[model samples]
Target: MKMKCILCAAGALAMCTATAFANPAKESEKTEFNRHWFMQLQGGASYTLGEGSFGKLVSPAAALSAGYQFSPVWGLRFGLSGWQSKGAWVSPENVYQYKYLQGNVEATLDLANLFGRFNPVRTVNPYLFAGVGVNGAFDNDEANALNDKGYTLGNIWSGSKAFVAGRLGAGVNFRLSDCVLLGVEVNTNMLSDKYNSKKAGNLDWQFNALAGLTFRFGKNHKKPQPAAVVAAPVQTTPPAEKPRTPAVQEAAPVAAEKPAVAEKPAPLREDIFFRIGSAQVRDAEKAKIAALAEYLKANPDANVEVTGYADAVTGSNAFNLKISRQRAESVAAALKAAGIAAGRIRVNGKGDTVQPFPGVEKNRVSICIAK
Candidate 1:
């Protein structure tokens, strides 16, 4: 008997777990890999400190970077940066001079909400990237002057020379629209060797902040279409007979009939959407919400069920289920504010279990009629 009771309890527990997993509300969808080409232009200021003919200088710098992120979470970036800095000569005579144009290329990895670890807020993502590449340096006018004076300036390089370099930085990427992104990042580059130019000697670090825009090209994930609207039926009234009917009334009075009233059809349901992995609705969904509010006002007896759904991007099955539920609850709250009766509405979140669409936007809300 004891063994039988234990088995029964285990079975009950399993059933409860299955029930929880079965009805996941939709809001927990994860962001997918972004495979597209992107470009950015950034300009900022940097202070250089290292071994160089010129001691130290602070200068304004600009960079134009273009790259492709094979997935939403990773990519490669190549940028050309140039700066002019004034440095004090440490040796013979104390003279300040400007030197070298620098450029490089590196791979970047995006860490913001990667792997569906967290809910996405705005489309903006903060990322930390590190990669190894090459930095090129060219001799400036200062190097030319030293050469003319017959000073033994090391390597008197005039064009670009490649040196091993790496970069570390943090940046935020904001999606302006479906295919455009605005990004800003600040990074510091460390070169393997010091730069030697006529004006400066050991400049070894390149640091700058960059801001630019990127255009994305690829297939867009499918999104739910707006609910279709159905108009109400119209009623017609019969025209009244003239007073001459009084003479005919002497024979037989005709009965007057009421006008036929048209029945109003049910209002269209509203659709709710969210940022990838987040419960917050995007601004684009405002119009849909307004339409929903109007529908609720017109149909007082209608009951609504808001079911949230998430994409298969992240989280354990249980966690995704919980996220989906929260998303539904959020929509329910919005409806309540729009005069929907609390008792007439139901809310639920279904994690990534059932996807309405195959892509990232699959994280969404479903509104069902209960009346």
Candidate 2:
């Protein structure tokens, strides 16, 4: 039956091996496992419940385990645990001493990873574990010791040897660093009725509470990424200079023609529209602003007015007023960037009353006029 149980457990583990790494992948997540194989050393208190004295059942227990984590969620461990428990039955007459040892094959489950782990603040993982193993008794002082104490106990081995042990436990581990974990675990062990060399209706039990550190080892595998390549810059040659023309004799200067009358300043109005609900100016609209800047640069004395508005259909009065102000500020900022004198530009943030376009979309505009 022990062999059958072991085979069944092995089979179940094989089936779940693939599922260990089934966590959903994320793009921004950069954390990775540095090592896979790990060893743990733990020490804690152990207790036993059987046909022994009930008082002071506590004893010292310790274990050393080695394991490989298949993924963040699942893994396997093998360990040997030593337990020393001193107690007796409730009657206080049948006192028993126990020295127990066990070697186990345990399955580990990381509960945090199994559930959604999106919260950044939660870094600790609580886990569940179960295992089956061989149990043996080292101190066989059952019958002889009870007789020496003048207690006519039922015929039973005070110190027995060689039985099966099964255990289930829960623990919480805090990831101290990428390669280190600190945790505490409590396991309860179950065994055959004759485990303590005494006849009992139910299986005997042992409880272990341990604190440990897991030291990880192995080469870390990194997620694959494509390499980036840069192109070399192209070089160009300068154009050759043309030969100078022969100098010509200077001609007599003629009287300058009467100064031409200054032409009337022409008013240039440009309307730039933005996408609905967006304060960002598109690429196409940038060209228009650039052209206006160039024209103003050519005509130094020219002054400009920037009026911004939003469509009433798209936004509330207060929102439209705010957006309109943003639109004017954006256009004014652009003009200032073009080397235009700040004093020559007048910015006005008006209500959504200027619907110059055929569609409501057209009303979301900033109008610039240079005179």
Candidate 3:
């Protein structure tokens, strides 16, 4: 039965792997997993190995654990799990229960992240774990009753017994949000023969089927980006260079009457940048919006064109387009709040279809041009 269960888990892992590969992942998500701490609480049923029917050996179980994820693929945790475990013999038709607590330090492997692209938003993650622990069994009154009845149970425990245990398990985790997850797991534990006080001649086996919630602490992504640098408005045309003086005196005598040319003032322009994956206008960017509003107010005839853009490197085309539109709308709203009439402001989002700036970070911006 244990071998069959192992095979079933292996088959499920293979199917998950196939599904991961079937989907297209252009780039891996850059979610920082280091230094994140998580806690889990679980409750379920436990089954112990015995000669009696399967239904006779089932009992209650629960567990609590806390751990740290070292990376996307690996983590370590310490957990305490156990409750009632039953031992039974069919020949005498006797069944007895005992309480036990097992504490284990286990290592975890995230199978989905290990086999496929690491996506922070991916909803489901399957994992495998193994560990070693010590089990403390006590409150064996039922076992004592069986022993007193001459049931031939070898060396019944009087008070308590402590023995080594080993565990192996697999589970699936459903991400509920940034810091919470729902999970289900099934694990088998191997313990010393004396744990059940039945002298079963071989090691005892205990199985747990559990469901739980995990709460994690720490940000999944790295630090929020710093404020973008605001570049000074650029001139559309270069300044005229000073003409060189004539080396010979004859050049002064040849001055001709020419039409006077009037130079045009440079158009006002400013850029408001945004942090990665965010559309909210920062306080620093607000100043630029106010300045742009002032320019519009100073020249009633001049209108400002606000165009928003997003980087091509981060999100999907649809996601990029959505955020780009949001970025533009946010800037336009800010301008309106600053007393700039909506009719005078023209706003549009280019998404990643156009790159107005050179760098990826610089592309996440809204350019305002007054003409």
Candidate 4:
């Protein structure tokens, strides 16, 4: 049963190692591997498996680790740990208590980050590790007495007071913010037979579990935002007194005649855009739509012509044309909902036409022109 438990922890560590290298972040996030540093402090419980009372087998454990992360997915860490271990050795019924300290080096893999890097809302990750190091008991009267009784601190695993130990473990970390992480890990340590003041003649192991925080030190750069969409012009005239036919029917363009004195030309175009293949306007664009409705209310004779277009890159011409029409009608519906008279509104679809704008992003647009 003891051997079986050690083997299971080792297997889990190995499996996580394979998965971390095999999977990568999603395409959308473009997660990159970079260099960084971190410090961690953790405290938890230790349990020894042999001679002590099942009740007395519980002990305290704590560790301080420093790591260099080659990337979010890979890191190397070194740590010092101290703990109390009490258990029976040589037989299932014998119980003893001992204090030990160990220093180890480990390779850590963030398995969750490897598989879920593209998740924009990613906040949690599971990690795996394996390490090798040295362990020793306190150099006190109790330890010296054990050494005299052939209770060597180091047996085949060590020739001096210090002995070798190997560990395999798994952990989970939750990212609390940009530079702070909280994690919990459990490790199994394989030890020399005689180190616990007993001559078990067989390998013995213990388990330590710790929860802690990692302080990350690095900068993550941000991508640039796209340029704003420019609205296209439709009319040369300003607000005029003469009312033309409602734009729903064909309305002739009214040329601006300079009055005795001229002022700035009123805006002729109001554009509202949508995501590719979507007819829905975003929240930011709704106020612009409402403003157009307000303008129409102020100039009772004014009418609007709404034209919608779809980008050519994302969909087929037939599909683009269909969605473009839907987008135009959606804008016209919003206008009516904002209390503009339906009869004065004219809606048109211009699908997949080479856009007036520079890129595909700006091309997924709908323009509202005052007539």
Q: Which candidate is the best by TM-score?
A: 3
Q: How would you encode candidate 3's per-residue C-alpha lDDT over 1-371 as one tens digit per residue?
A: 53454467567656655664455543344333435899999998898877887777889999999998888889999999988999886776988898999999999998877888766666778888999999998999998987888787885786888989999988878779868989888888999888888786888888888889999876443422334555565566555665765688554565564565545445688889999999999988888888888888878787888888887666666888888888988988998898888999898888877777666798888888887
State residue 318's C-alpha deviation in candidate 3, in Å: 6.9
Off by over 4 Å in 2: 1-28, 32-35, 51-55, 118-122, 147-155, 158-160, 218-371
Lowest summed lDDT window (length 10), candidate 1: 219-228
The window of 10 residues in a row where model 3 has the poorest summed lDDT is 219-228
Q: After aligning candidate 4 to the native by TM-score, how far in Å is the CA of 91 from where it should be?
A: 8.0
> lDDT per prediction?
0.59, 0.69, 0.81, 0.71
Per candidate, the number of residue pairs that clash is 27, 6, 0, 4
TM-score pick, better of 1 and 2: 2
Model 3 gets an lDDT of: 0.81
Q: Rank the candidates by TM-score, best first.
A: 3, 2, 4, 1
RMSD of each: 18.2, 17.7, 6.4, 13.6
Cα displacement (angstroms), candidate 4, residue 92, comes to 11
Residue 37 CA displacement from its true place in model 1, Å? 2.1
As for model 2, its CA RMSD to the true structure in angstroms is 17.7
User: Which residue runs of candidate 1 sit more than 4 Å off their true CA positions?
Assistant: 1-34, 50-56, 83-87, 91-103, 115-123, 144-160, 198-203, 218-371
- Which digits, one per residue and each the tens of the lDDT, describe model 4 over residues 1-371? 54454466557555654554445445336423446688899999888666655456678999999999776667999999977877553432434566788999999977766655533224556688898988876533444445466645443222235669998888766668656878777888888776665556787778886889988775321222235455554446555565554565667777785465443436557778898668998898999898898888877878899888877555667888888888889999999999998998998888875464665687788888875
* Per-residue error (Å), model 4, residue 289: 46
